[model samples]
Target: MPTTSTGSKSNPARHDMSVILVTGSYDHEIRFWEAWSGICSRTIARTGESGQVNRLAISNDKRFLGAAIHKKIHIYDIGSASSDPILVLDKHTNNVTSIAFNSEGQWLASGSEDSTIRIWDLRSPGNIVHRTYENGAPVNDVIVHPNQGELISCDQAGSIKQWELTDNLCSHELTPAGDVPIRSISLASDGSCLVAGNNKGQCYVWKVNDESTSLPRFQAVTRFLAHNKYLTRCLLSPDAKYLATCSADTTVKIWSISPGYDFKQEKILVGHQRWVWDCAFSADSAYLVTASSDHTARLWEMASGETVRQYNGHHKAAVCCALHDGAS
Candidate 1:
């Protein structure tokens, strides 16, 4: 709601109650900003030896910040600017690319360039409960389902694997017919369906039925050729009414899904200067945030399809980003 200048880089994190946490990249710090006012309430910076931060995830309670660097996961106690991480997870041999905290905040999931996914128990430092590997492709993203005891992982090969945390084994694999490399996968809040975008500039939605035990498969309910280039990211709105996708074609499209049976496309959101890497909807589904290779993140009004605010200034391409409400 608050207005700011373009060319400013801020890593945004959403809290439980919908408040947003905004952090500045390249400047080497994090800031807690009031979502509506856009005012900085707190500032934390790297103090010791760590330099640049690539990705960030706040704990469920918003008390801790988990940052991914080249090869380590640094856990920082919020409000403390000290350079030291309360816990340093070094299980990934390659760079830690992404991290996420479960709804309970009891477990942390991390994916890395090593083509593996690791789940860690927050109660026990350095205790990794599960470590699973893909044949060779790097694990690009991992997300914990809202209600189910499952985690979904996507890799460079465009394959999506669902792992049951309780058993710590892959329960299902959703592979496209053409084997197009999947860029991102997000589950609807109801846990009944999943939407995935691939490098082929196509997006597919799968209905997850629990009955089939043979091979984990999904019936493709809807397909959208939204971009001419690779589709980099896909996000489902909180209400599950809308799905937003970003692509290498330098545009973002919003699709409306019919309520009960058939999931169909309804609209398109088009605005961006270059390839869009990531896109997310506000908690209310009224606004959208997009990060692009042009080194800027723009906020879009969902209803009107207008560019509201732009956050720029990253020295290099902006790869991944999120919006935080600040309750944590």
Candidate 2:
């Protein structure tokens, strides 16, 4: 993990090269912030047919920021002075719901409401899509396994499908909770656990086992109701120590990951005025950043359960945020 700069928090001009935090909103703009200071350093207008930003992802190498808007994915240069996007991937027919980068940062993976998942090769000059997989249902989330050999995706039909990277085939299909729509999915960075959350505020857990198979198998662990309202997003800490779930109830709940996969509620982050849409864990897994419909994003300390910094520049609802604080 990288340590944040020891500079003054009120200094807006001092930018720390170690940390990068950005937020996208219905306000039709993306703001780059000084994470420790809560200062908006740069603002890029996201206008035209791209529509509102639905999700945001930072490449592992911290070279680019991928924004999923409407039916297109815009890639922006993070270290450059220009505000223009260097590349735009326009292949999805419907809204691009989720986006992520591979561990090497050589490729990008995205899932869409068009019922497909596409892998874009970042090293190619023509911006070629390496491959595409049809999910048969609107995909809500897709994540690359830590082993870099597979992809796991959850859809509106309440199905979790595991795709094998080597053979390009679906190896496992799991319907954890009947036919309810699955809103989000998260995998532990160490490949120890898999979690999926649904519209009914339920969360299901599974342990990743690699016994006698080339593809990792999911052993059922447990399921619990994490929220009373809609569960908007679920994310696992990079260290696999905590699970964070954002809800329409305007709170983010953190669950402690026990040794035996017994997850228990550790804290409930209160303060957001409206729906808590998205959140990201610091590389050290000690802090959290949350975006809300209240048009603000806040940084919270896990142990203290208090807001350490508040980012309040968005004109409309802040829907998504991306953070990269350490090298992969």
Candidate 3:
């Protein structure tokens, strides 16, 4: 455990529904921020510089923080007295690219450079991986479906796999021609659409058949090109109303979607001086946080595309983050 590495003292007077915002960077440190005040409430030191934080995920109950680094995942008990990680989960032969949890927080799923996805039982003992799936290509991201029964994974080979946990089988697979390594993936809240962005900055969207129980189908919805630059990340707002994307072009843009899921560019957010790596919307989708190569995490007001507060602390590029508003 380490002392608060950067800012204000740890304040315990926040409301029960205080939003938790955690950002990790090339600095090898994870800092927790009070999103409203721009104060860093807690900082967890990452001693070994195996790699910068590639991604982060928070448990549903807000009891744990998961940080994905090179070949390893660190689980920090944010609710506990110590700032040190409570557990270390590792096994990947290369970088662990993405980390996420089931809606119930009963399982944690990781995607890795080793081309595998593993599900760990958080409540279990040593070596908690309860199930594993092999894709044979470096996995860039893994996202648990809102249904909580399927894991959607995209990999370097540009393959999309829907692993059905309840049935213990792969329910569907998509292998795009000239597969160009999909880098980011996002699923709509209603399980209505799925989107994946490739290294070429091309985004592919599909309509999902949520009612299907076996051999589900993803009909091609639409494909659009985000010019500017290569894609870094694409995220759908929690309410499923908008799609936000980050790119090497150094901009974060929002897209408006119709009731039928037709997407159109709504606005562009510009402030970061370098490549924008990731962005996540607040619980109400009224605020947005973006990580950038410019070494900052910015909070933005979505409506006016104005910067609300700039969280400045990371010594290096801020690459990824996790946010929870603590509301059901």
Most TM-score-accurate candidate: 2
Writing each residue's lDDT as its tens digit, candidate 1 over 209-295 gives 664456345656777675778888888888888888888878888878886535555556666677787766666778877777786
Greater-lDDT candidate between 1 and 2: 2
1 or 2: which has the higher TM-score? 2
User: TM-scores for all candidates?
Assistant: 0.81, 0.95, 0.92
lDDT of 2 by residue, 1-328 (tens): 2465564568634678678899999887899988877889898885564499999999888889999988989899999877788988988999999998998888889999999999999888776889999999999999999889899999999999999989999999899988999999999888889999999999999998884777558988899999999999999998998999999999999999898888899999999999999999999898899999999999999989999999999999999999888764
User: Deviation in angstroms for 327 in model 1?
Assistant: 6.1
For model 1, the superposed segments whose C-alpha errors exceed 4 Å read: 1-18, 23-34, 37-52, 81-84, 127-130, 133-136, 211-217, 260-271, 326-328
lDDT of 1 at 160: 86
> lDDT for each of the candidates?
0.70, 0.91, 0.84
Report the Cα lDDT for residue 318, model 2.
99
Worst 10 residues of 2 by lDDT: 1-10
Candidate 3 lDDT by residue in tens digits, 31-134: 88877767887888756555778999988888788999778888888776576677888777889999998888878999999989999998887858888898
